[model samples]
Target chain A: MSHPAKHRPLIALVALFGLCLSVPAFAQFDAEAAENTFKDNDCHKCHHATKAKKGPALKKIAAKYKEKKLDEKEAIKHMTAGQKVKLDDGKEEDHKIIDTKDVKVQTNVARWMLSH
Target chain B: MDQRALILGFSMLAFGSAMAADPASIDWGKIPATKLTLFYPGQSSYEWLRSEGHKGASSETARGDSCVSCHDDAKEEQRQGAKILRGNHPLEPTTIAGKKNGHVDLSVQAAFDAKNAYLRYQWKTQNPFPGNEHQYLRFDGKEWKVYGFPKLDKVVQEGKQPGIYEDRMSIIIDDGKVPGFAKQGCWLTCHDGQRDMPKQFTKEEVAANALLTAIKKNDVRKYLPDTRTNPSDWKTGKSVEDIAKLKEAGAFVELIQWRAHRSHAVGMADDGYVLEWRLADAGKDMFSGNADSKTHQPKFMWDEKKVGYKSITADQLRKGDHFLIREQNAVPFDPNAGWKEGDMIPDYVTSREDAKGSAADNNAIANWKDGMWTVVVVRPLGLANSDDKALKAGGVYNVGFAVHDDNITTRGHFVSYVKTLGLGAKADIQAVKLP
Candidate 1:
């Protein structure tokens, strides 16, 4: 089932283009802007890159959402909605609402957290 | 005068005389109580309050915003305490299994007579039984060793020792002298290297510290930020002479603690101040260590003739009062009284006669009943002692309160934000003038 040599090159180019298009847009999010928002809101007080403080690590959060087949919409909802969250300490508290209303900014930060 | 008027006049005269001598006789029903919610603080030291980890409030705190400004909601302390008391919270590294409550409602009332200012406090205990027992000296097969520790101590956490500690109520007063006290409260004296706090000092670090070595102190305790050139660093202390000058100017917070086991038996509260260190006044306190340092044995034992026991066993804890008052119920410890491996004696002894000078100025009366403690602390007015804050009439002062419970000490206590207390003038908790 081998293709012709000339056809093989065209197929390879098509496969490469498809791979590029399949990459998630989260890879191209504005990381610096998202981090600034995180810090300005003091989210880093509980969250860290890889280590858990009062909140879960960003990497762990990202993995959890990914396993559930969720995307940035859920992350944005968590940031904006003041919902009850169970912490690592087995205590429940209202999650801190982020300090912004702009959908663009919220989307960026959510994508940034998922990128971890 | 009519018969009813005559009887009323006689009763008023008797009440006045009793109130002057005894604060307990004050009509507490006439005085208004200020309700304060004291919450478990965990390891949130002065450094933690200003660090980036404090979240959105760090900058505000650095700029002299009072804790109450941001946490002004009635339920805020309860919220914070419940979060911090749980296991693995950022503030609480170690958790006690038996601790269930995160906050306590402290009812405070104040009144001033011509001779003394009376502060009455009441709070419910977390445990059903009162915490009147402290550490003990337990005899093993060979020699006596220290037994029982605070719930937060490593030995208690590891199950090597049982949790046993006294409950305490403390008040720190600043008479508009120490800067930033009105804004920051007790956090100004709590720092990074203090015990059970963030960046706790190591033994080696304490030994090498210039100020600690100069002061002959082996452990770090509560200290004012002004004592150090770098307010954030405990090691960067100013000269002793500078601290002396600060003391002369009354730049210190007066610390008065009423210990359930130590000074309560003698009806006195230990008087001290916080400046370069948490220091006692110019003279002796009402309590002293009972164990002999040289022989590692108790210096005094219960008078068997009175208490019917030379030493108690582990099962006798909280069953009755175990205080060994030197002038009343204690006798010299004897080595040949059929000593056993399971016998236990108190670690501290109390004495009212031994307390002297400024340290003996504060008096207290406390009773625990129906799972609550009602305490009245009597402090003399117009004290000019260099070690004390002169609580004068019509003077408003900054005051902070703390309560230790649940067999714990150090940072395991619940604390309150700063509040203004006026002797006669109007403030947060005004002290009414007694008739």
Candidate 2:
């Protein structure tokens, strides 16, 4: 993977420019709307941002999915499937299905949770 | 008029003016029953209801929206209860293994005469057997020790004691007083630091609390938020004098409880109010702790002559009635009365004659048949007592109902959201005037 010394600087500049171009696309997923949807569905009753309540914290969930090499599709499946989840208390119950069938809203929430 | 007719007329006048209204005489079939689904609340206290953890409803709760405002669907209580009873839900931590049904249907009927308001409640038991046995004093080989506790208790969880508690029906009434009661109902009185609730109070913390110390209370119980400077914290209670003023202004929710074991045998319900604490009214209640404070042995034992046994054994529980009514079957404990290892005595003793003042204001009669409890509580109307809610006709009051069943106590009960009860007026559950 060695690169020419003269081309390295140009490569760094192009990568920086690419990141700048993709920032708008990343920002297009409205965080506020995702949060409102989460709240509307009362998801925060079990899930929290940083601290673990009944369910795993969003950060821990994100880290788990990332470490497991899972994608947004897996997260979406979790939100839509209502599969049995083992809570922090070592008890099992069906996870709450997100209160929406709209793929875009589900994708946004899934991505928002993963972003944590 | 003739002499016999005059005497009859005089008797009728006396009966109309002086005698209390009989619940049996009231035609319950004619009165409409409001069907409310009482659900197990677990640890969802006032603090939990308003905390960010509540998510969608926290903002609405903060803005003074009633619980029924958003959870207005007919089956909302059943839905919430089912989730919580699945156990290890956000609201529930401890799961009772054999516990099934998350909700119970309470058929409530109200009727009012000139002197009393009769509230009849009917609900099926989760267990096949009625919960009439409470905690007991057990003789484990030599020394007597406490046995049987609520499922939520650590001892019961650890298998140190069996789950044994009485079924109870409770009503918390607010006569347009106690701010937020109409919106939040019993949640305003339930908070963190209460027993079996979230953020339960430590012994040191309870001992250090100024309000608890002043009141000489060892444990935290149901209390109004207005009693505390910070509505969410149990330790931040306002001054006793301030609470007194609140009581003077009639800003407390009246707590009336009919216990299956404690008060049922005596045909009474314990009366109390929530302010700085869940305190009994002005005087003594119908039931008191049966164990002696110093000796730790039971103060009363069943009269062998009356009940055919001095004390019951572990195997005798739920086989039949085990109440230790002082007037009916209890006698002073005799330490030398052929003590045995398997003997057990009731932890509480009930006495109708011992009750006094506002604490004795409520009367109740209940029967269990076909796995259902039919309880009728008779409350006097136009009560001028400081501890009472004065359930008068033409007045609507915010009422919250709770039923503790299937051998449980404390937070392990099914509860209802706030509903208006109008006595001879328009409300959520209207009480029809008697003929």
Candidate 3:
């Protein structure tokens, strides 16, 4: 049999493509959605995606959640509004939002984290 | 009046050898923990979550340095959460009202007290930020009007205990003495439980007529009364007047919790605990009737209309989950103070060590100067071990001290705060470690 190793890269590409294709039917969501949310919301004010910046890092966040795929819905709930998050350290803060209506930026960021 | 005037009202103010505010300032052994009441940040609750909860997100990023970082800044931030409070109040369904029917039987009295009602009606306003609204409370039974709470806290403390339950949570109002709701009869239960049905005041009720009700109702109105400084109320902006003439109030509540341990160990014995939650952040920057993030003042209540804020629902507030109680060493009461406008206090987590669990030379990040009994911060590690299970984390603690004059009585009053992980999560807490 041909070495499966030679085709591994291609296999990964296919998986990535599949994820990109499965957009929700109701709303316009993409893997980069959360990234957009981050930008639009100016989350950089206190956060970064994969590192503990002003706030906790997004990567450490990924490690925290046991679920393989991040949930955009839940992240959005926490984003546009706010949610409770426990950093590696044992302090607590409420991640609430000022506005909830049309908070597309948050949704987009959630979409990005979901894909990553 | 300026602080100078107030200080002058009394003599040069000397406590012990140290020149101080008064004789009570000295730490002579211990004094009665008699009239201590916990003050919870009303903003740090469910009601606040719905309104202001969703803003300004943070995490315990420095391993275990989330709250301690900004709050325990004695050097700068004055992170005095623990020092100023009795202990931390955890969200045990048993403690909160309406959360669960829960554990006890004295609820009739407890219900009569309605935990955070005082704050909601008196201190909490529609807007909690941007000059944050400040108001007083006057309850007419049918409704709790937005109004200023009595600032007579010091007044009451200085005077007689007024035969009040100063050490616990609620305040009682005697029958036929209800403030706004005089019809409701005597008992005017304030922030703490001060009344119940059959337990009506006997001789005391007949003597004093004013229930710690609304300032207006309190004939003397010598206490903390509402001075109409509603900068936000678009329609009407009034000034201070008779306490009774103007009536306003709303709903807001918050609390502080405490957990005590026998030894410095994470998990120990049947240590008692207490929690003080705030009903509202009604006290605004008195300089400005509004609150600005840049210029934030920790006021406990405000009226929404005057502050241009829309009223918020408790359900909306609860959604933010403001109940994550922080544990700390309970600072004793020989002294009392808060993080000032431009002050800096180091985090005990990063600063000092408690005598019990700490390394001798003393090095964490901060340490409470062991000089006077003023409330100071300490640290305790929390954990549990059973079978092959072990859990541990850093818990900020507080211990307070009081001095009892030789004449005050020998029971030497004292209070030292310890951290408790509480009863529920003993199992999962084993492996956890605070950075």
Candidate 4:
């Protein structure tokens, strides 16, 4: 019998192209677009890279969810829509919402935040 | 003790004494500097943004997160910021109202010896013109009225708002007594119900409530969460009893202001604190009007016997400019004199007697040249006054800065976000050590 594995590269290429075409209609995570959303909202004004400012540090946020492996859908919703957050001082404030309407952008931001 | 050893000890003591006496004399060039590139945070005024065509444009940047992020060039950033402000206050955009649309990049240098901390700030002005001409109300041969209109107000109708005010720089300091300053910066103080803000309290409310009726001020000073409790619960919903408790707890932000003309005349800036625009200077708020309000007569004429009050010509009164009261001394406001339509009163003359000890606390020196104002303000560190936030060595503080220029007041000024300043220590926004 002809070795099926010999044609594996060709089969993989075709399958990848088909997958790309199928996913084109839905929002795919883009790192650059997520970064753009973060920048546009000036989220760094309070949330810093390493240390906490008015809000928690991005690294801490990433660490908090690293173990939980929370659903990405809920994370994106909270980031875009904002939620009440208790601060270090025991005081609470509505978390600042990212400034965008597109779901793709929101998804990208969520991915970027988790990656931090 | 050995004679040589005794002499050496005396010399060391003398050297320490000199450093303690003049901490302000530290050479700024030797000190490391922190350069801050501040951008105008856009229409900070809530009422202005809610208007038509102006909505949703508050954070709409041409590019980048903040103003300077995309508009890297200072000159270009200034112009673009001005364009935004003009779009908001359409009637008189640009320097006609003496408004600088954007943030001025500031270079701050800090030095601390054994006793005090000194900060020297240098920033370029939007325009070369020094805003020394403060409130100028001219006698229209009948009553003293505001000389002209500020750019913000509707034209033709003369508003009580003065067209001329001194250029000013202010610093709001928090030593952790004031809550939310670390998180929210100046916004904790700048909320509704304050003067010149939406839903401003009526005069009747102010008169009845001691908390509302603060110090005699043109507008309300900034408030913190501890004092202003009604709006939020992180110590929110503050009552009269709550305010008294806060005061007893010493929960208030310290405000230091340096005026170009008013306080500068006395060679000191005024120090005050806030509750609800309840501004009280650390010392006497000197420099009262010479003209009696009801009679409008010159209560105290310029003593021609001591120094003659000179008359300023119409030519000296440049068509679009003339608030130069600091330079001109005032004579009696003679209502019977031949007064023209554009004749202005001498800028309210400051009385030296009223400004003796009260004005000498916060010493300052200002020089305006080459289109920038370099002001060096010197205050002794660790003032143990009950009202003062005793700036300690190696301590960090949450600070907010504001600048008033271009003949406007209230919400019409440019502001900066929360910045941290450390004495003898370094933070993210560090005030580094002197050589």
Candidate 5:
């Protein structure tokens, strides 16, 4: 009778832990997976969290998009279809090309980059 | 009896089989496969001169290497360097041969940035073969991408055959070939209605086209960082003294390329004698204007009212007044490889042998009919050799030489030289024999 009373709290805690493990851990997009995707696809070649390259810096990508109120869907669609962006000399360049399928991942990377 | 017959039969079978296989299949003469090379300036990756056994590089070699060792085959078709070459055709050796390299000046690129892409075609000679096309390259944000090679049905508008013609070709980048994106994967490839209008473009233009094609074609799998077949695996020349300096950078990007099919349409005309000149020992600001001139052109500085060298540059003459001094030998710098035949290379494509370095007493090669050679004359503004004791700031020199066939297309050289010398784009420098 005394042993049963002592083990009751421990058994209750184990049941709660099992329930937690059964559900999927979700926090929007997976950052590491998206980053690897960007690198393998050459996105990282021109972009870096802290540095800039032939393209604009990606760290500020999230803030720019957020300010523009572009969500995952809108961002991916824009990237896959190139737009005439303002070049350094203020010329219009109709040359960027990443697709809509890459949006969520790109957005997550952008957000993470902005935060980090 | 059966065993002895079987042995004999096997030997006979092997011998007969080898004989039957077309003798043409094997190139007993060892001719290089004709392939054109176009390179991009920044991404030149060809490192080593040779991989495994093959030689002759259309790309840059490893750090601190030379362009001559592997391209040792001066056998006409594969000779390297440039000169004012003249050919008689076929056995007459009509195809001009010395090959040199150039760079894409960014100033030129800035001009093209306004357009989509540029295309080049080099026909071996004027005898119209079918199917010649120019390829285009498009640029992505960080890298250049290729738009599909629009099969330009043979450019049939007949222009003068021997005359050089160059034009820019704009391409549509978003033709929708790449898988993921709308305007993503594109391409450019040199195809004429005919095949193999090979050019000796600087390794960068060749590499640039190759790299963009690889990325767009998704052939990136074969792009090992160390493969000679790829430009990224290329090596840099320690001293490609013959090649143009801008080519060492990225000037290839901004220029249009052309192949001068030998002229059957236009013969040497009388408007003005066309001559090709390569800037040898050309430096700006090294010499003070002799008679108080302000311009930098070598010729203009020396002659007050006289334009440029009436015939050649000031530094071209032999050391002494009478062209007898063996001190200044005639080496063709326009196509620097002209001076290059020794134990290293014996014969050019024309089968003319370079018995020895031309005798010091020799200036211009005189064996026009006996062998194949081309001579270029220079008209410099003012050049006194830096160390030549007999010369002063205003001392003018005249140097000219005939080296082994340089293979430079007179029209091609004129098109480029005219632009480089600030003579404007539409220059008409027809090749005429000048004394």
Candidate 6:
């Protein structure tokens, strides 16, 4: 069987695109671990996929943060420092902090929220 | 050939064929079907691991992600199969070694007609061996002793907990009656301070509390917001006066549970739907512990003299329906009878008449075949009961689903996100329109 030598450049380009999309923002960033932290921190109870429950939708948060050019550090500070978020009922509650000592995990979790 | 003899032969053949037909068989092929993948609800608010202990956590501030949002394919992720042994909160690592994990892949289908809605689920259990053993307080040749406990018990935590529990399937429905269910789903009802939590209530506490006793239940399952003055409060300081007010206000959620070994024994399941408010059972379970303390014999036998315990060996238990000791009529525990250490009697069976108005109206049929259980649950639409959230036509409602298999129970079961089930229109999680 002869190898397709003419398609080598095309294959290389495709592989590069896949790697760019798959690489983590940080060296220590773990998407799966961060996702687990998101659930454990009770982030899912209020935010939904596309709809607003108690707070804003996650997609909305992702869009707003992305548009403003927010980095993982800023996202982590917003989540851990307990910013006041307005509810649908116009009531405000202190944001629940992501309870973890590892700052790397926290940053990874923030990146996940921003990725959404 | 004699003409008269030939005519008589034809007449006999027609009569024999007529007797063989049965009308009770369900025509599942005619029903509209859709297949879905159902995974376990990873961590509910009740089981969330927060820094400030289990206190101060409310459904209002819960995370927005659904189970599927994070852990999409559970079977591959949780392959160890023993995560349930920890009961969602393990102070220590699980002691049971080499046990299966939580990644169950389920196939679900839904169909409805004018009167009833049918939901079918199929899943291959982690343990190839079926677990039908249940809690049995047996006679130890002297005093009647509690022989076995579910895996959650402290005594049973070290690979000692008998893997004896009924596989259960439940549906949480919200039809505009229960508030915040569509947004929060089952977590609205299953929060901190309930049974099997970090701050669990003792049996004495359940017996003493007016609200718990009024509902005739010993465990907490689901509670609505209005049922408590502070929906986030998990304390037990409320007086009977407070509970009475909540009851009068009619703050409760409809919880229907179907146990393979419990309700399937006496051939009644639709009666298993229980209404829970403020973590109390609004109705009575179909089968109760029917062993007479004095005699140790079952108060209610399967009319065994009428329907003998169908003899079944271990090989016959591989597939289809098989006889379990829990499904048979109880016999008196005889201390002098030289019973073995692991010997047990059939769980007490209750008749249809015994359940009465306390039963919820839902029907179920289960068959175990090829390391899998195919369960069919049927429920009527537009029930007039005050507690039940009537499943209506042309209305979209929030629904949560949970499955308890492999002899585990409580928060250890798998859960789904709050999905929209539209009767006739478009929905986020569709339960297709029936013709």
On lDDT, the stronger of 1 and 6 is 1
CAPRI quality of model 4: incorrect
Candidate 6's TM-score reads 0.65
Measured with C-alpha atoms, the lDDT of residue B261 in candidate 2 is: 81
Taking chain B only, the TM-score of every model is 0.95, 0.94, 0.17, 0.73, 0.19, 0.73
lDDT of 2: 0.83
Q: Write the per-residue lDDT of candidate 1 for residues B138-202, one digit (tens) a residue.
A: 99967888889999889999999999999999999999899999998998998888888888899
Model 4: chain A TM-score against the true structure: 0.70
Candidate 2 vs candidate 3, DockQ winner: 3
Q: Per-residue lDDT tens digits of candidate 1, residues A1-116?
A: 98989798899999999998999866668998998788656677667788776578899999999899889989999988989888655767778899789999999999999999
- Residues B59-144, model 4: lDDT tens digits: 32211123223333324434434545555444123333444456667776666655556667677766567765565556555665
TM-score of every prediction relative to native: 0.78, 0.78, 0.21, 0.64, 0.23, 0.65
Summarize candidate 3's per-residue lDDT along B1-435 as a digit string, tens digits.
Answer: 011122222212211122211222223233212222112221132112122322343222212223222222112111122222223322111111111111111110000011110000011111121111122122223333332211222333344211111011111111111122221110011111111111223444323433323222221110111222321111121332332232222111111111110111111111111111111112211012212234232122222223222122222321221111012211211112322222211011110122222111100110012221122111122212110011122221111212211111111112111111211123211112111
Which prediction has more favorable DockQ, 1 or 6?
6
On DockQ, the candidate that comes out on top is 3
Please report, as a residue range, the 10-residue window in candidate 3 chain B with the lowest summed lDDT: B111-120
- Name model 3 segments beyond 4 Å from true: A1-57, A60-103, A111-116, B1-10, B13-40, B43-435
RMSD of 5: 26.9
TM-score of 5: 0.23
> What are the per-model DockQ values?
0.03, 0.03, 0.10, 0.05, 0.01, 0.09
In candidate 5, position B189 carries an lDDT of 16
For TM-score, candidate 2 versus 4, the one ahead is 2
TM-score of chain A considered alone, across all candidate predictions = 0.83, 0.77, 0.51, 0.70, 0.55, 0.71
Relative to the unseen true structure, what is the C-alpha lDDT of residue B394 in candidate 2, on a scale of 0 to 100? 96
User: Candidate 6: global Cα-lDDT?
Assistant: 0.55
